[model samples]
Target: MSSAREPKAPTRPTSRDYRLTMYRTRHDAAVRRLAASLRGMPADIPVRLAKPGSNLFRFGGRDRRPGLPVDGLDTVLSIDVDARTAEVGGLITYERLVAATLPHELMPTVVPQLKTITLGGAVAGLGIESTSFRAGMPHEAVREMDVLTGSGDVVTVCPGDDLFECFPNSYGTLGYAVRLVIELAPTMPTVALRHVRYVTGRELFDGLAEHVDDPEVDFCDGVSFTPCESYVTLGRFTIEPGPTSDYTGQSIYYRSIRRRDTDRLTVADYLWRWDTDWFWCSAAFGVQNRHLRRFWPVPLRRSDVYRRLVALDRRIGLSRRIARARGQRREAVIQDVEIPLAESASFLDAFSRHIPIRPVWICPLRSTTATTPPLYPLTSGTYVNFGFWATVGLADGQADDHHNRLVEQLVIDHGGHKSLYSTVHYDRSQFWRDYDESAYRQVKKRYDPTGRLPDLFDKVVGDNATR
Candidate 1:
């Protein structure tokens, strides 16, 4: 483990509190606005693109750290129900996307668990879900996009285009995705959900792996509540609407709250079911105690409750303030590592022994489904993504930092790639060992030669190279 370093002081919040409702579809106006902003800014300043600031982890500075800003990019530009495609502007939230698509009996093939995540963030970060085993990442579903380049060029990027291929995991370093033509999938009226339980970790992993190639399964995810006990739930679209119930409104379906066996759920209800208490994984946030997690219905919708919880820490200003005041991070860590199928059993065992992060989420992702390989490092073969999200202990320098590095090393050693959505402690060399730095640099140079956007290396590993 590396030596413990003091937590840096908290600067101004990078993301300003803004509302997407202020503006409507204006792609042409947005293009001209972005072009003018880029033209006016100095060449050396990197440009920053942001959403409404509800990400569970920080990818880059919320505000433009070394750059100029071009705000109000979040808009749904257009929705083509007949073509089953949506032309989404930069920074549009998944919630808005879902609302628009549901009315047309269609939805994006893959949506991240959280509705707070932006379409662009999912494209740039790790956006995988139970359905990912078939549809791949959210970015893969994008047919094309209109990008406002750092060099002040408004170019259309198709699936195979250089800019389009490298856009995922670029963290807006390449340019701002002004308009995205995303492919949508036809959705059933309801989802036939089945919960399968296993007594052992090996059994759970193997069972989940077997269904990766199953054509019938529309969505699949596993949860590890303890070292041994786990449950894998598989859902398929159903033409027949099962017993209708409003599960999304008032229930706490976090992993802890979910049953080992369950019934059917509406398509929309099942999609955002984990919104309450993050599938009971918020136990790490002192919400694990059953008593604290159960709150009376305040008339607020299920989506509102979960959205508030996701932003609670930031709104209260407790964790970051404490870290800044004490030079230590006391908040929980969220990470997802994509592990090859063959090594999962042993890797899960190693995780149980070395890390105690609990209520772990296991999701399968397909390598073949994704047309454009994400800029982030992902193993080539089909893999299982282990979502190790929890607050093991306080980041009092040595212990937490050591634990984090150990987890990263475990992922690398076991043929896995760590998702860069959370705090990335990797040095430049370590990052490149897992990522393709040369390819990233080449793409950045082509689209953003003036350094208008920050490079992937700077965003993930920082400017200073570490041993």
Candidate 2:
């Protein structure tokens, strides 16, 4: 065994303060017998197993609540996985679980914004994605869940059953999810990669809706970015199995899926590319920031992209320019703002008019049916999420603040909201606007009446989740 242990940081909090040890064993969780050994430790902090390298560890940051406390941490007990359904450890990342179930030809129905999220996180928190349009949030993918209740016991919640309505996106608020049993779509061999370009916001959004509505597009959708002048939107659809005229189906592992192509990549490389955000954000930010990442947003409008498609060619020149400038970033805040899908075009136009921030890019996330109400209430209909990734200069703080206010206003104006998954120093009103208050309160009152999860957020839902 490796003698090296994780460095114990004196500054890192202990269970005494609701901080627990986070563990990552080489193969399995070494934490199984922890309940007995942790008898003397602070009861507040809970043990969590980090998703073993899979990005889909959990849909949202809260789902994998690894090391996050249960006094505030919510989990139910006993997980069971069968031929039709499989129960997974809440801490199970998507990759391991997917691979484990491969022999059975089954996969989780709903995944997260990114595949790296954990199964528990998807069931409990990872809410938005293309799969949502049809199958719904990762929770809708679940047929039943084995949850550990606040009273130190377990219970089951099944779809269409009496105790079926536990809110999945509550971030474990209803209970700690020990096991989640979800259904799977038939396994496919390869996905057809379709690439196209859009010219305006109206066209971009309309095109997305039409494309995502198709079932064969297993992972329907594309990313937009500005290569030279106009925004270019690339759409991808998973090809159905048959003798393909183009290419045969190959198992796409994550590594090959995530790549920094000025064009397209396999499933895995496209998902985890170190430069994906850069690629994803480049459409609005200008490939200039590649000084930091290879990928940036791909713009949706053709006219919005740079005239030249020299993203890879211009790397050297851009890098030199950035180095010469020194200290100040030539790029902007990469501001990440999201508005509902249906409300996208209007909000996009409104936000662009109000905020002077140039090269503002948009990333959309459609609402799902299985979404829980109030907290992450299922919208009356689908709402498109527009991410305004603003590229600003440090000198652009005024612009940043100005756009942030625009963000706050737009979020409220649209009946749609922004991304809570990513950090965006928001005000209480913004969070309240994004989430439902009454639903949050009811869940908070039920399990964590002591208010131990306040360590959870800085502003919204009472500003304090303390026990």
Candidate 3:
């Protein structure tokens, strides 16, 4: 045995380790504070979250009650580069998550199109993007979650748990997620896109179905400009470096789809390509005009900014007033519905014949697992999510929800389900029937036995006051 002791190694923590420690400390404190706040609230009073903004299109009456404070919950807690797993705050937006992970060459398995869509919102309310065909919805990527139940207790839930299975489309009626551990996927420096044009909807669906399972393709989506014109855009990750196009400035991303056969974008831009123009809805604000776009500030060109403008218009009823002044009544026909791949063409045809909103967004998705979520029971086959946002003129005697009702019936007839984030016109019995009432009630009863939060039907389709 040597008498002299070997030199001791330094015990100081690395920068990344220190940061992760602080993040975890902060998250734990935040969760405790939120739980206490929920407990302090009166039992009879219904609770609601005080979010800074909302992506939901159902512009319901404001909940006058004070909201639960969630100040410190929006953050990326930790990213394990080796395991490709991220522990993030539920309120953290995908934009921040992307910013944090991109440097590590990792990203969430399925990142929604909009930058402001929070991870919790995406998981609880459901979200889809081009990658959904293989990766499934945002909830599917979550390995575990810490949810603040309506009983004012925090519990960790994982796959195979009843709460975990039913939580996706529960829309916060059960409880709110505070922290989630989600899986990540590797990424390259850039993405190469091919805009393949088709003459008809049938041809477009046929072509799109072929690429859904293509191992070479990493992203798949399409734009239907009209009944006669459609284009399926296929994107693949590439290490090949090239001069990528910039759509944040004078050029626009959606327009590029029509004008170019091929395009390239940095991974960040590729993920948010639709957000730059709100999927071309910014044209309604005249930002697409060559002259106006020149003066528009680059930083203000975002989906959230335009959404606020739309909200303002809704608050003041400005668009309704303008249309009424012009002797026309317009119904806002904004909705996203997922139809089976086989029936997508028929739905599109009926939609075009009735709604007249063009440039429908088409993204295909499939269940990554054998069993489907109970709340939004999508079968184990492929489905096409059709998103259209535009106002259509209502004839003199038409109900305000005439177009929306038509859409609901169309979805039902086509063996599809409509996303509840937007306006819903289904009757109570029918709504519960479609959403699986028995399953939802069981989960809701267990998580929120006292009915602290509004029921799913009440939250999405009930009176505006409850929403």
Candidate 4:
């Protein structure tokens, strides 16, 4: 050891320090405080680390309006670069994580298109992205997590642990993920992207399969405007920049039927490429006004544009009134169902005939379950997520329910699973038929013995008569 008389060296900037300094504050103690608050509370009480406006809380049949909201947990805890991991609070957004990791030349393996997605939401809600075909779901990339149980116990969980598997798609009904150590991978400064057009679902699947299976391809997704017209986009991290292709500057959104050539984009641009137009679906909001789009583009680039739109809808209250006036609970249809690759053609055919949604996003995702692991929502298979979202004219509220059940039937009939982020019409039998509730219940009992959190079945299979 050096002598005291000797000048001491300055403390070097570590990855942890660099990352922690990026955030405004650290609320590590808030984890246990939130857990303790839930100790004798009513089971119906809802707990969240973030505000309700940040998420689709009222989606599906359940209206999870917060009773006891837990705020101030949105902060980046730490980032350990040497271990290739980033420890983030559950409420921390992907946008913050991106900022913390980019300085270190690292990125989360799988990030949803929306940067507003929280680490806990992504893990608990089963988030996947274009890169999910290779890296698997965001939950699969979790290295470790600090979970607060209903019994006021804070437990550290890791992969292969019993409670770890139940956390995915549980919707925080089992327990709250206070902190998470997410695995990170090295990323290039830029990403090279190419789009290939396909006339049929089979051709689109074939193209997607080819790219997903290719080791060189880093990201892959497909957008179908019609049953006969689709485009498959494959992206790869690249050091050398090729021809410039900027989607933000175009007259029409990139997801439109217009053909495009290979181009290069910054990694951030590649990740949030759809934000400018919300996958060409923002035409519903009049962002499609070509003249206005040219003059004003900055406001459209906001990451929370979708959330803002919902807030505007709620603020105006006219949309809800319109639905009420029409005796309808829904005026739009937005659902994502992940089905086996083989069933894609059939499902798309049915989807085209039923909903006929345009700009259908199809992202290939590989299941991460073991060869014989207890069955989860996503069974072992090569699956493709079909994001079918569009306005559906409903004669009454019951019609929306009919559409919900019809879609659920189509998914089940085709051997697929639904994304719980949207409305789920599954009853107890139907829900258990798709998920291994037995295993989930066991894990729930072990961690949340007091039943402080909401019941899993109650939260997932809401008692709404619509179902």
User: Each candidate's TM vs. the true structure?
Assistant: 0.83, 0.61, 0.95, 0.86
Per-residue lDDT of candidate 1, residues 1-467 (tens digit): 11112222212323232332234424455667777877887776555543335564553323434333435556665567789998677677787888878888999888887767778778866588888888888987888777777677777777667777777877767777776789999998888777788888788777887887788888898887788777788888888845855544444565422553656777787777766456555444555454654553433333435545655765577667866796655535678888887777778889889787777888888854444354565656778888876655554455545677778888888888887777777887888777777777777787778787666777656423110
Alpha-carbon runs more than 4 Å astray in model 2: 1-84, 102-105, 113-115, 149-153, 159-166, 172-175, 214-217, 226-338, 351-371, 387-391, 394-402, 455-467
Q: At residue 400, what lDDT does model 1 achieve? A: 47
Candidate 3 residue runs with Cα over 4 Å from true position: 1-16, 465-467
Clashes of 1: 6
Higher-ranked by lDDT: 1 or 4: 4
* 183 Cα displacement, candidate 4 (Å): 1.0
Candidate structures ordered by lDDT, highest first: 3, 4, 1, 2
TM-score for model 3? 0.95
In order, what lDDT does every prediction score?
Answer: 0.69, 0.44, 0.87, 0.71
lDDT of 2 by residue, 410-458 (tens): 7778776543443344566656555666656654565445543341344
Scored against the true structure, residue 438 in model 4 reaches a CA lDDT of: 86
Residue 164 of model 2, lDDT score: 33
For model 4, what is the alpha-carbon lDDT of residue 221?
A: 84
Shift in Å, residue 94, candidate 1: 1.1
- Residue 153, candidate 1: Cα error in Å is 1.7
Prediction 2 global C-alpha lDDT = 0.44
